[model samples]
Each structure stands twice: as C-alpha cells, then as structure tokens.
Target: MKMCRTAAIAAICMCGSVFAQEQDRKFEVYGFADLNITKYWMEDNAAFRGLRYDDKLRVDLSHVNTYFDFRPNGNTRAMVELSFQGDPVANRSTAGTTVYTVSQGGAVNTVIGTLPLPAAGETKVSETQGTTLEGNSKIRALEGIVYDWGSFSIERAWMEVQFNDKANLLAGKFITPAGVWNVDHGSPVILTVKQPFQTGLVSIFPKSQIGIMERGRGYIGDVDLDYSAYLSTGRIHNTDETRNSLLIETPKDLAVGGNLSVNFPVASGLKIGASGFSGMQKQEYRQRIVKVDITKPATDAANEAAGLVATGKLDPTGIASYIQTKVGEYVATQALNPDNHSYDDVMKAQARENVFGVDAVLDVKKFSLQTEFNQQRIKNQLKNDSLTKTTGFYGLASYKIPMGENARLTPYVMYERVMQEGADNNAGTFMSGSNTGTPGSVLEGFQTYVGGVNLRLFTNFIIKAEYSYADVLTQGIYKDHETVFDAGALNIQFSMAF
Candidate 1:
C-alpha cells in the first residue's frame, strides 16, 4: 500500500512538471483578410491605347493572410505568414515562322531559296529552279483568359533570436525594413485603400529578402533610437527569363542594406527614418535553338549536280565534291546564326542599383500627418554605360472623429508624385518599361490625388471608401512623339483582423 501511494505521488509530480513546461512555451495564430470592389475609368487617349485595365466595375478578393508565431523559449521565436492571391490565367503559345531572304552581295541566293525559320528554331532550306524567291511569314501568338484565379504563397518565414535588450539576430525570408508603409502593409492596418506611390507603385526597395539581419533599440534621455542592418540575396531582374527557358540560375552575389530611425514619445507619436539599399542586378536573355537535319537538302543539291552532269555541264567524279562543298557551306551558315544551336545565351546585361528613402510621421490629438520621399538610381555596367534615375514622394493627412465607445470615423487625403528619367513612367500601373536614349536624360512624371474615409465599426473590423485621380505625362521620344495618360478610380473595401 505504501508503494502504490508513492507511485501515485510520483506520477502527479511528473504531470505538474509537464504542465509547467507547456506554460513556458507560447504559441499564437493570427491573421487578416480584405476584399475590395472597384469602379475604374480612363480617358480614350491614343497614348494609353494598350493599358491593361478597362473602364468597368470589378470585385476582387484582394488580400488574405494567415500567420503563425511560436516562442518555444525566452530567447527564441519563429514566425510564418501565408498569403492567398489571385489565380494565374491560362495561356497558350502558337507556333510561328519567319522567312528570311539571304543575299550575298546584291544577288539573292537562289540555291538556298527562302529559309523559313520557325519560332522553335527549326529551319528548312529548299532549292527550287527559279530566279525569284518567295517569302512566308507567320507571327507568334499568345492567348489567355481575362480573369485571374486564386493562388497561395508564403509571404514570410523567419526565426529570431534575442541575445539581450540591445541586440537580436533574425534569419530567413523577412520583409525588407524600409519605409513606414511597407512595414505595416496589411489592409487592416493601413489607413488608405491604395498604398503610396513609392511603396506600392514604383517600389524603390525590394519587398523582401532572404538572409540575416541584426536589429535593436536604445534609449538616449527623452529620445529613442532604433536601427536595423541586413545582408541578403538582393533583388533579381528578368525573373521570367528562367521561366521561359529550361536553364535555371540564381544570384551569384549578396546585397547589403540598412535603415535607422528616431522616435519621440511625446503627444500621440512622432518618428523620422531613413533607409538605403545597393545591389548588382544580373540578367541573361536566352532562347532555345532546335537542331535541323541538312541531309535531305544536301541530297537534293547533289541530285541537281548529277542532272547538270548528264546535260554535259559537269563531270560525274565531281558529284561527291559538290555535295561536300554544299554541306560545308550550310554548316558555316548555321554557326553564324546563334539561334541554330541549342541553349544559347543571346545577350547579357548587368547593372548596379542604389536606392535611398526618407520618411517622417507626426500625430497630435485627433490629427495625424505622414510623408515620405524615395529615389532609385541604376547604372549600366555594359557598353554605352549610362545612369537612370527615378524619384517618388507622397504626403498624407487624416483626422479622426469619435462615433461611439468602440467605433470611430477617420477621413484622410493624400497627394503623390513620381518621376522617371530616360523611360516611360507607369507608376501605380504594375508595369515596367526599358529606359531609352541616354540614362537619366528623358523626362516622365506621374501625379495622383486621393481622398478616403474609414469607418471602424468594431475593434477588429473596418470599412473603407476612397476615390483617386491620376495624371501621367512623358516628354521623351517614343517612336518620335510625346504622350499623356489620365485615369480615376473609386474603391470600397472590407477589412478584418483576428
């Protein structure tokens, strides 16, 4: 009986120890979702003829995110975020053929005829007994559905280790520490339905990076200072090149970036910050080259040589020599055309990019103000090296009016401007174009005005409505002409956080 009682007490103690360990480990699951209905329109200008969006009303499941945060011990924490996005559209590529008329000196090569080079890189050379060559051409076509479907992606997955009050180590894929808007980018958290020009439109800094970061905070009298420094894989350009080809490549070098900010705890809140990023972007354009068999064409040419010999125009012994010469010339021509070979890197361009941003925010009583400015410069390292520059700025202000104990109404207004040199500016449109002329030599500008109101019905739910107007102008030579584009949109969104 004493042994049984001791065993029961021992089991109870073990249970208590397990419960205490469980209490020490902390886990949290939280996320936010938002849906938007938008009405959009644009003037029928020739310059904006090929714009992606049309004048119509649309409903979109804009953002859905789920986050997991776990802390197994006092010094370590892990976080993961999953984002649901619109689905990709189905697309099909149609085969095409391009015919080339080869002419050595001033006369066309009648023996080769017109060579039909298909998009797949397969070519056929047919010889005809004619003085003139016929040309045939077919354009490549791509067709896809108009609407996007639903998809899932991982937004952030990272682990953080706390060394002390003044230092912490973070590793994995994390959001880049840049401006205020990018850090608090959730729909439920941001004040406006649309993000600022710099943060969302012409992102001066990359959205995320994979690497390690060291961040900490310190106090100096009444002032507080926080800073972050990181080394990451940097930004990638021409990402679609790999998707279109069979070859895969990753960035060969690392990028370094950092940010610093100062905050004052007076009134509601006040903060000022600056950020910078520098990296080298490498791109290689490649295309697939299908090998073609020249045996049939060479045989036909040799047969023609035999017919000439039968007509007393050549000797039978020269037939072998004729075939060999023809085959050699065909091989030489294929060598000159890189497309005739398989897996060729057609062109390579390398550029170094530097970006800088400054931001400030102030809150006093029910009134708040926020503003930011960002600039990015790209320098081409190849021949005809030139520099291209892009700049963006925005100012926002809002005022809150109390509605009830757990509800409030906030109205806000914003003005933004973005400019690019030596390129066509497509800010806020989610499209980018190559720079032309001398870098930083052409002038392009975009301006936007926005007004909105937010109704916080509950602590974790909000309704927002906004109207925005945009004007764009380009003063550079585009096929030898100037261009302008203007548009407007009305958006209503429902956002919730849990």
Candidate 2:
C-alpha cells in the first residue's frame, strides 16, 4: 500500500508539472476526484455459508479527473476531461484477535475491524473482496483496480459554443445533462454514497454520448426558466471491439436519439423541473444454447404456495416435462466449484439484445424526484426467447435545517421500484452474478428503500451516515416467482469540495 501511494504521488506531481506548462494561455484546467473510506458487509447464510464482511474498512481512491477548457476569446470554449483512477481496496480477517483494523500501508486503528460486516441482522453487501473467513489482515481484493484504473486519457471530450449566459450550443462526446446526480463526479452534493445505482443502468442513460445541443435560459416575469434540445450519435460502449460488432447485430443497439430539458421556478422556495430523452438503443450479444432444468415438488401445495407457479404463467404439465437437469457450461464443477469439478470446460450459451428508454427529474426545495421508464422492443426476428420489456422509476426526498449559524442537519429518504415486463426472464433482480433467464426459475425486479441522516462541521467537512434496505420479491415475467433476499447497507463518508 505504501509503495502504491508513493508511486501514485510521484506520478501526480509529474503530471501536474507537465500540465501546468502546457495549459493554453487562454485556457483553464480543473476537476475533482472522490477518495472514499468505507466498510462493506453482506450475509446470506444459506448461499454464503456464514456471515461475513467482504472488504471491511477499505480505502478507495476514485479516478482522478482533470478538465481543460480553451477559451479562444469570449463566449466560446472547447473542454475535455482526462482521468486516472485505481480500483477499490478492503479489509480482510486473520486468525488473530488484533484483526479489527482496515489494512493500509499505514497503522491499524479501532473504528475498522475487518471491514464492518452486517451488524447482526443485516443481509446486503455493496462492495467487498471475495474471500474466505480464514483470517489474514492483509488486503485480498485487487479486482477493482485491475478493472477500474489504468492509463489516463480524455474521458470527456466536448466543445461548447456559448452565445451568452442564457444561450449556447454544445457538441461532441459529453456527460448526461440530466439528473443532479448524473452530472456529479464523486461529490456528495450529487448523492449520498460513492456511486449511484443508475450508473450501472447506463443502458438507460445517454451520458457520455456523442451529440450536439442548443440551450437557453431566462425569466418568465419573476420566475426563472432553463431549457435545451439535443441530437446525438448512437450510444457506443462496444466501440472498437468484437462485442461491439456483435451488438450491431443484436436488437439492443442504440442507433440514434434526441434529448431535451426544461427547468423553472414553481412558487416561492419551491421549484419544478422536468427533462427527458428518447433514442433507439439495442444491445449486441452472442447467441448461446440454453440448457433447461426444472425441479418440481411432488405435492401441489409446495408449488402452489411457493409462488413459482403464477396464474396462467406456469404450465405444470409442460414444466414437469421440461424438468430435466441440464447444466450450463458455467455451471460445471470446474467452472463453478472451487474444487476439482470437471464441469468448468463446457460451452456457455451467450446472446445479446438491444433496447431504448426515456427518463426525467423534478425537484422542489426539500423534495427531489427522478424517474426513468424505458422498454426493449422485441425483435424476435433475430432470436427466439421470452424477455420481459421492463420499466420503472425512483423518488427521493431530503430536508436541510439551518440551525441559526454554524450547525447544519439533513435527513433524506429515497425509494425505487422496477416493474417486471412479461418478456424479462430474469424478473426484477437486475443483479447479474446470478443467472435468472430460465423459465419458471428466475429472479426478478429489485425494489430499494434508503433513508439516512447527516451532519456537517464548518460546512466543508461532512459526516454522512445512511441505512438502506432492499426487498427482492416477485421476480421474472410479471413477478411470478418469489424468494426473500432482503438486505441492508450502512455507510458513513466524509467529503469536501472547493
């Protein structure tokens, strides 16, 4: 860890010196990075075997971002952001009593002991190092780095031609201009945690999409209003790759789209804002052979009450006939088992699809609401299988109390529900590590509820703690099947912005 920090510091100093020398005489350079220290815990006694804290007290330094803007003269400028980042780190338990500190190249402390595991009855985990309970204080997970950090490059490249404060036009690749949290870069002002769930669903957002847009702002009488209209190139995560090319062949591809936003004061301290985007998106995937395995209960009571057989959804006779245990390529002993299981060499069925969606946000003082609803248009011409066209939305509310002068307090709550579509074989559980595509046996849509409190000292340094609960029930095509995988996450973070 010490060596890691030392090398990182040296590299930053070198980069800063070089950049300072290269800055455009009329250009400005600046950006921000989020550095987080968190403890993640999850418990699924049946599936996990026992309670555990994946990466207890771990430190994660997010990707560092630096943006440069060339102001040729007055109201016009070209801007781009270069970024460098490292994966996250977490605590590991060892077979010793003094194992309660987050492992760092630094000294051990009390607040962190083997990355805070779910306190007694908790059942959820956000991020952690996958490790056994055998106990070693050294850090074990380095996956985040292998995948998250690398050579720095222009992550956001765009040019803006502004006519004035009230109007402008922007073109090139850029971040999404919708949702307060969407424009955030590791800052607390945009959220309550290190990341937002919507980011993983970029399948739903047009952020970083290449495009050109027009904007304008002004006041209607005593009220202020802002708006924009844009057109963009198709969303492209598959750029320069075999997977991308394969997607061009799939139905979930984003061929093109248009986006727009409008914000205005509602009344007094309240405000109403709405923004929406629509586009053609499709995903590319490799077609794979699906092996079927259906386990049926001898008694109808178990099948009836178990919630697997929804009304008119499950064909008991057909389901019974299809109950042959055929393992997938990824399901074999060598592939899924840690031991010498030979099932690892099988070929797993791989397929892809494309979809499109629209989303918007509205805020008024202590209450802020955001919603996203999109569907994957079925294109059976490409393949044959049932995929539920999914849709959902989320809302959040927060209140800040200004206590006289120095003390500030805030309380927040948020809720999200993803509706199941008859086509979604996986139900509502968007979580991937587990497979849910097979008929009659699949996980479905996810519903999450979050609430927390925060206190700020001096307004610059903040201590925020939050508790979140998620209930995953009624999954797969119309939420037919059911199980209980309820869990909770508690996180406290310190942040500063300038």
Candidate 3:
C-alpha cells in the first residue's frame, strides 16, 4: 500500500509540473499577405511615363508577412516578423538595354544605352548610345516569373522586458520609432497602396534599424504622454547595383534619434508630437572617368587667382584664391587621370544629415485625419556647397462607412508634395549633354494626389483600390518637353490577416 501511494504521489506531482509549465508559457502566430497590381496612363507626347499607354500590368507581392509572439511571463515578451517582399530595386530596365538618360530644359528627352555589365577587369557604365525600352512587360527573377518568389526577409525581431506599467526596454531589429507610417506599416492597417514620398523619399530617417529603445508612457491629470528614444546602427552600406540584396550589411558609424508626444484630454484621440535626428551617413556617388588637363583651369576665377598670385602683393582674398587654384589642379590630376580611373569607381564620402519633423493625428468616431511635415538637410549633394534641405508634407483623411454588421468600408484621400534639390523627375527621358544654365541639370521634385477605398470582408480580409495622379516639376531647356507631363495611375490590392 505504501509503495502504491508513493507512485500515485509521483504521478500527481508530474501532472502538476506540466500544468504549471503550460500556465507559464504562451505563444501566438499570425500573419498577413498583400498584393498590388498597378497600371498607368499618360499623354502621347509626355516626356517619360514609367508605363505609358501600355496595357501590361505591374504585379507586386507587396508583403507576405508572418509574425510569432511569445510570452514566458507577465514581464517579458518577444516578437518576430518575417516578410516576403517584392524587390523595389528591380524596377529599372535591364543592363545593356536602351533607356532614357535625361530630360533637357523640360522639353527635350535624351535616350541612351544601359552600359553592359563589366567583366572582371572592365568598367561598367550607366549610360551609352541606345533606344528606350518598348514596354514594361519583362519581369526580373532568378528564372522566369514561375520562380520569382520575393525576398524572404526578417522585417522585425525584438524583445521587450517590461519593468512596470509605464516603462519597457526593447532591443533588436525593429521598425523606426518615429513617424505614423513607420509604426503602422502593415498592409491590413495602412489605408493606401503606396507610401507617401514625404515619409519615404524625403525623410532622412531610415525605415528600420537594429537598435535599443526605451519606451514609456505616463499620465498627468488624465492627460497622457508617450516617449521613445533609440540609438541604432547607422546607414552605411551602398546599394550593390551589380546584385540586389534584401538586407543591407556592415553598418558603420552610429545614428541617434528619438520621438516625444502628448495625448490631450482636450479632445478624444488627438495627439501631437515632434521628432529629430542627426547623423553622419556614408554617401556613394557615381564614378565617372573625367578627363582633366592640369594646365586648364576648372573655373575662370581659378585662372585669375593663379595669375594674381604670380603678379604682386598678396591680400587675404588673393591668398585664398591661390590656394583654391592649386587645390583644384591637384583634385583634377587625382580624379581625372585616365590611368587611375574606372567607370565602376564609387566615390564614398561621409556626409552629415539632419532631420526634424512635427505631426498631428485626430481620430474621432468614424473619422480619422493625420498630417505631418518634415524638413531634412544633407551635406554636399547639391550645387554651391550648400546643404540640400528637402521640404515635404502629407495630409490624409479617411471616413469609415456606417455598415450594419460583419461588413466595413473606408474611403480615403491624401495629397503629398516633396521637393528635392537636383533630383530626377523619372519621366523616362535621358538628359544628356545639356548643362546650359545650371551646374546640375536634373529636375527638382514631384507632387501627387491619391484616393482610395478599403473594404473589409468579415474580419480577416481587406480589398483596396486606389488612383493617383503625379506631376513632375522640371527646369531648363527640357522643361517644356511635351513628354515631361502629368501621369495617372491605378492600383488594386487584396490583403488578409489572422
């Protein structure tokens, strides 16, 4: 009897241990898949349209995202999100094909051959002599379209150690802490098919980073405040034009930034915030084989300076001019010498970049409105040695439809404008050999209009269709180019989450 009782006790203890283990551990798995198909239309004489008048469709697996969340206890949690995302970098014509190189003064479009991929010892060039591609039907993949599974990438992996109700520490590769889009980038959550240029092209902040962040929330007399700050691996790597990659590697230097915000009890669901960052980024510029004669002056002023130095009494301005002349000659000799040059040479430099922004969101009942404005500056990419300060903003408004039950719809519209100094208009023109008035010949920026409707079927599925119109701002002789005109595009998407 004693032996039987001991055996029973052992079994009960084991069962209790198993029960406790089950109580302490929890795991949840969920995911979403999103796809987008886009079509474009443009005028016959428009300077350059990405897919003008072509019935061909552009299909993208925008995101196939999977998430795993684990909780060992009340104070600890971990999450990981893997995404199979379509490659945006592959949106260019194939190497060795003809493509438009530039648009002149807004009126003239220049076309050129895509330079062949260089061999082991040869140099690769971006432009040559050729005709523009006829249509946008070819899809890039390892094989044909049958094998073009998009990149399986780790989009987010992070762990959180919660100390209390108001504080937590998180670390790992994560979405950026600032910006509304950065926080709500999932397909089921975002309302638009395309990301705004203000948050993407014009913002100096990176989309994601490997870092550590301190986040917390507090209340003051019923008003609430939320804050986050992070130190992350900086932007260092360059896009390997030779081969595309899903993840950038070998981050150098450091990037530090943070966000602070307050929620007001003055109104329901109203919040305002500001964010800022400063860092040094490694910039890569195209390598060109510039032919320079040391005897020839790069600027007429340089020649005058040299002559003044050879003549008479030196003033501070003259001395400075003389130094500039000598430096110019030295740089030309070092950079333009044919024997030391390669078309594949990427000139790398560390440029200081600064960004600041403010945002507000108002959510009331079925109506939601949000807007953000950002200004960013980067060193030494534009003319006259001045910082290229880009200014941009976007305003979005959405209204949820009043459906009875199990069905929901939301209609939304957004307007965005982003202006960058000396950026390409991408209108499908080659601006070649046309530097008449300005030191650089590229166009300035773009403005866009977007409208869409989102439909939710039951709880797990979402359907979206959107239309956009874009206009390019051009300068110089190609400015009036008939082809450099406005463009309209349509995008449709379906998404599911569980």
Tens digits of lDDT, candidate 1, 418-464 = 88764422111123343322233233777889999999998878999
Q: Which stretches of candidate 3 lie over 4 Å from their true place?
A: 1-25, 43-55, 89-149, 201-203, 236-238, 241-252, 284-347, 381-385, 422-441, 475-479, 482-485
Tens-digit lDDT track for model 3 on 1-498?
A: 969944743443343221244444577657777878988777666544432234358887677676777888899889999777774322322243233323323322333222233345433333222112222111111101112335667778999999975889999987876767767778888888777866553344666767788888999987788888887764423234322122234443467888888898654588898887755554343444433222324555654556533444434344333333433343335544556444643423334567788888998988989888877676642223345556778899999995667678899999987776632211111221112223443556667899999888767678899999877666544666624566788999998765
Error of 1 at 214 (Å): 1.1
Q: Model 3 residue 283 lDDT?
A: 39
Best of the candidates, lDDT: 1
Ranking by lDDT: 1, 3, 2
Which residues of candidate 2, in runs, are more than 4 Å off?
Answer: 1-25, 44-57, 84-155, 165-167, 194-196, 199-203, 238-259, 267-381, 384-388, 403-407, 422-441, 458-460, 474-484
Candidate 3 residue-pair clash tally: 25
Model 1 residue runs over 4 Å out of place are 1-25, 45-51, 87-150, 236-238, 242-252, 293-342, 345-348, 424-443, 476-484
lDDT of each: 0.65, 0.47, 0.60
Best by TM-score: 1
Name the lDDT of candidate 3. 0.60
Candidate 1 lDDT for residue 82 = 79
